[model samples]
Structure formats: C-alpha cells, structure tokens
Target chain A: GAGVSQSPSNKVTEKGKDVELRCDPISGHTALYWYRQSLGQGLEFLIYFQGNSAPDKSGLPSDRFSAERTGGSVSTLTIQRTQQEDSAVYLCASSLWMGGPEAFFGQGTRLTVV
Target chain B: SQQGEEDPQALSIQEGENATMNCSYKTSINNLQWYRQNSGRGLVHLILIRSNEREKHSGRLRVTLDTSKKSSSLLITASRAADTASYFCATDALQGAQKLVFGQGTRLTINP
Candidate 1:
C-alpha cells in the first residue's frame, strides 16, 4: 500500500464485548507502533514492533489489551471485555526501520464501547 | 511516564501570524520529531531534529532542539487557516528504547 491502512474506520461495541482493529503498514517497513487516543486526549503509546517481535509492551494498559503482527506486514489489536473507558481511536504507524526515521500513520479506528 | 508535555495546550492565532509550540521531555533522547494531526485522525510527520543538531527547517516549518534542556519547539511561519490542527512532539529515547514517546499535543486554531 502507498500508506499505512487501518480497517473499520469506526466501531461501536457493547461493553464486555471484544473488538479487533487491523493495520496494514507500508511495504518493507520493519517497525510498527500502536497508539490510543481518548476524546481530545494525547496519543498514548501501546506497543512497538520490530519485525514481528514486539520489543516494548510496557504501554499496554492492561491484560485485556493485546496485539500481534504477522509476516511483518499486517497487525491486529484486540481489546477483550471492553469497557466504556476503552472508547478511543486506535492508531497504527510504520517506519522504514526502528529508530530509522519518521513514521507513517494510518487513518485510525475509532472504537466506541457503550 | 516517559511521555513529553506540550506547552499552551491550546492556541489560537490569525492567519499570516507565526505560531509556536513548545515541548519538554523528561529523559535523554536520540532525536525529537514534530507531527501534525488534522481532524484527530492520522498524523503527518513535520520535522525531526537529532540530538546533536540544534535546528532544522522544512519549508515554512522550523524546529529547534535543546538537548541540554530536554526541550524542543516548532515554529510555523505565516500560518494558514489550513494549518489549524494539533501538533505533537515525539522523542526516540537515547536509552535504547526505540519506541517513540509522544507529548500531549498542542491544538492550534488559525482564524481566518
């Protein structure tokens, strides 16, 4: 793809339900990132991936939040037993390589847990 | 907790005026980058300044880094209404933490 792509631009899920957000990064990019933004809030780092391995998962809010990237191309963020506070926009970004340079972002997935 | 903080949480300025946003971080960084977000969706990279470099420029954007003070600033010259959006600063920690930590963005509104 010419740019990072995220699926399901918007999602509304009932509390306690599970939702999955997907991301397809630019070709050949070795570094990927996941971030979350609440209503009018700052971007919160969730995870970072180099290749298919996540080097930093310290930002994951809780055990309910998990993510996986395969073949170093597409990634998925899964939020289990979602709560109302989990409502936010999940963003994905890719860079040529870890610490290589700037990152390209996807349009993001807006998840609303009601 | 490694995230940075942006100053003047919200700013409003007229078109053609210069707008400036500042960011401060708590840890040593290998580089600092500035990004712009429109409509709160995707973010576009604006500029990056290496720790060793004091300043850099891209078109109408100017970025400066003060590694000694662990701070950075973005200056948009002759701002346009189209420039109305949120600006963020991200840092690549020098401690080998390759993840980019972002600041609470500065929302700049340009009035026509």
Candidate 2:
C-alpha cells in the first residue's frame, strides 16, 4: 500500500467480548506503531515493531492487550475481554526507519465497546 | 503517561489572524513533531524540529523548540477556515525507536 492501512473503520462490540484490529504498513517501511486516542485525550502508545525484532509492548494497558506482526508487513492488535474504557480510536502508523524518519498514519479504527 | 502537554486546550480566531499554541514536555527528546487532525480523521504531520535545531518553517507554519526549557510552539500565520483542526505535539525520547508520546492537543477554530 502507498500508505498505512487499517481495517474495520469502526467496530462496536459488547463488553467482555474480544476484538481484533489489523494494520497494513507501507511497503518497505521497517517501523510500525500502534496508538490509542480517547476523546479529548492525546494518543497513547500501545506497541512498536522494528522489523522482525521483539516488539516494544511497554504501552499495552493490560494483559488483555496483545499484538503480533507477521512477515514484517501486517500487524494485528487483539484486545481480550474488552471493557467500555477500551473504546477509542486505534491508530496505526509506519515510518521508513525508526527514530529519525517522519511517520505516516492510517485513518484508524474507532472501537466502541458497549 | 503523557510526556507532553499543550496549552489553551481550545482557541478561536478570525480568518487571516495568526494562531499560536504551546507545548511542554518533561524529558529530553531527540526530536519533536507537530501534527494536525480534522474532525475524526487521521493526523497529518506538519513539521519536525530536531533537538539540535531551534526553529523550522513550512508554508504558513512556523515551529520553534526550546530544549533548554523543554517546550515548543507552533505558529500558523494568516490562518484560514481550512486550518481549523486539532494540533498535537509529539516527542520522541532519546532512548526509544521513535515511539511518540503525544500531548492532549489544542483545538483551533478559525472563524470566517
């Protein structure tokens, strides 16, 4: 893809239900990031992947939050036992390289946990 | 935790006027970037100033960074209605792989 792509523009799930969000980063990009944005709040870092290395998952809010990237192209963010507080816009971004290059963002998936 | 904090949560200005927003961060950063979001859309990168740089400009956007004070500001000159959006400041710490820590953002409304 020419830019970062995110799936399921919007998702509404019952509380306690599990959900998965997908992100397709730009081709040849080596760094991918996930962020959560709540209403009137800044983006919260969730995870970061640099190539095939172990991801930086320090920002995952809880054990229910997990993510995986395969082939260094596509990634998935999984939330188990979702809570109402989990509702937010999940943003995915990709950069050609890490730390120095500019990043491009996806439209994001608005997750609404009922 | 949010490492950056933006001031004047909301600002309203008439078209053709200039708008300035300030951001403060806690830790030393390798670089700081500004982004803008319209309504519920994705963010668009505006400008980036490295720790070694003090100021940068792009079109009507001017950005300044004071690393000594751990603060930055974004200035939009001769704003237009299309410029109405939420602006955010993101910081990339010295030890991370560009994992950005963003501020709450400043909502700017340009009145016609």
Candidate 3:
C-alpha cells in the first residue's frame, strides 16, 4: 500500500509570504495530523482531522496557521504571512484512528523562511 | 507543547550492544508508543504499550511501561548499525483526544 505523501520537499520563501504544503494520506485513512519540527527541537503539534468532522485546531500556533482536509483524503496546511521563526520541517501523518494505532508519515516539506 | 522528555539526547555504541532509552511524561496516559526516524525521513512506528500492560516485546525490541511513575523505557537488544537513528516516545493522555504528544527524541549512533 502506498504510504503518506507530501509535496514540495523543500520550499524557500521570503518573510511575510504565505506557503501551502500538501499531504496525501494513505487510502482509507480517516485520521490526519500536521506537526512542525524545528532544529534541535521536538515535534510540535499543529492540527488534526478525523473524518469530515471539524478539525482539532488547538495545536495551531497562531491564527495565521490553518489546515484543511478535503473529502477525508488529502490535506493542506497553509501558513499565512510566514515568519523566519516558522522555518522548520512540516510533517504529515495518517493513522487508522486517533487511538493507539501506528501512524504512517510522509517525507515532509522543509520550509525555509528567509 | 511536548508531553514527554527522553533522557540522554544522544548515544553511541558498537553494533550488537544493547541500547536503552527512557521517556517520562507529566500526565496520565492511555498508551505510549515508540517510533524510529532515519535521517531526512519520516518516523516509523516501532511499538505501542497500553497502560495496563507492563512490558511487551517485538523481535529484538522491548518496551516497558510504568504507569505509577508515568515513565516508559525502550530496550533494543543486539542492535545493528541500521538501528542508528532517532528514537522518540509519544504519549496519548487519558483525556482520549487521540492526539499524541511526542518527546524531544534520542539520537543513537551504532558503529559497525
């Protein structure tokens, strides 16, 4: 089975610009999550979606950061007015459900804000 | 915010040696999981231990959970060079939100 996939393995953008990263989860996966990993830091939760219900946006750092999952399949994470501090690897993962199941991850989009 | 903290940010050992990593969390959890990530790659789930279970094993990997202490340990016996990667522990708090809080991770280097 194909695993999770993300687009734009590397992205370089100027400060204040907006960037959108895409993630394609595995087929039949009902749970999707986004996280950010900074250098020498741990994984920071961003947002999560389960099925077509409203997403759990509690982890989103600010209003500028938003994510949407369409048709319960693909998801897009948008960072508006990106800042240099937002530079990090954006990771996407999908699991069968939110419980204690294994999560499959994508290669991630490494965004660099210059 | 990160929920777990892994001890010993980095470790180095020869192949065939046993490697042990520990993780401690602040809150009660329904289950704990361990993952491995290669350089520049996404994380791969290694094992999961529920709160009721004390210890579990898979191949050469061993995971132990201590709910009383809110801590867990992962032991890799006879580690190979390929096991040289980053290890992370994630916790699913008892709240049942389904979101996992990950640790800072441990970088293990195995010399062949």
RMSD for each model, in Å, please? Answer: 1.0, 1.3, 1.4
| Chain B, per-candidate TM-score | 0.97, 0.95, 0.95
- TM-scores of all predicted structures: 0.97, 0.96, 0.96
Indicate the residue-level lDDT of A11 in model 3: 98
lDDT of 1: 0.92
Model 2 chain A: lowest-lDDT 10 consecutive positions: A94-103
TM-score of 2: 0.96
The DockQ of predicted model 1 stands at 0.85
Interface RMSD (Å), every candidate: 0.7, 1.3, 1.3
Best by DockQ: 1
Chain A TM-score compared with the true chain A, each model in order: 0.96, 0.98, 0.97
- How far residue B94's Cα lies from its native spot in candidate 3, in Å, is 1.8
Q: What clash pairs does model 2 have?
A: none
Better of 1 and 3 by TM-score: 1
Stretches of candidate 2 above 4 Å error? Answer: none
CA lDDT, every prediction? 0.92, 0.91, 0.91
lDDT of 3 at B57: 99
**For model 1, how does the per-residue alpha-carbon lDDT over A1-114 read when each residue is reduced to its tens digit?**
899999999999999999999999999999999999987889999998997564588899999999988888899999999999999999999999876599999999999999
Give one digit per residue, the lDDT tens place, for model 3 in A8-113: 9999999999999999999998999999999767788899898877898999999999999988898999999999999999999999987558788899999999
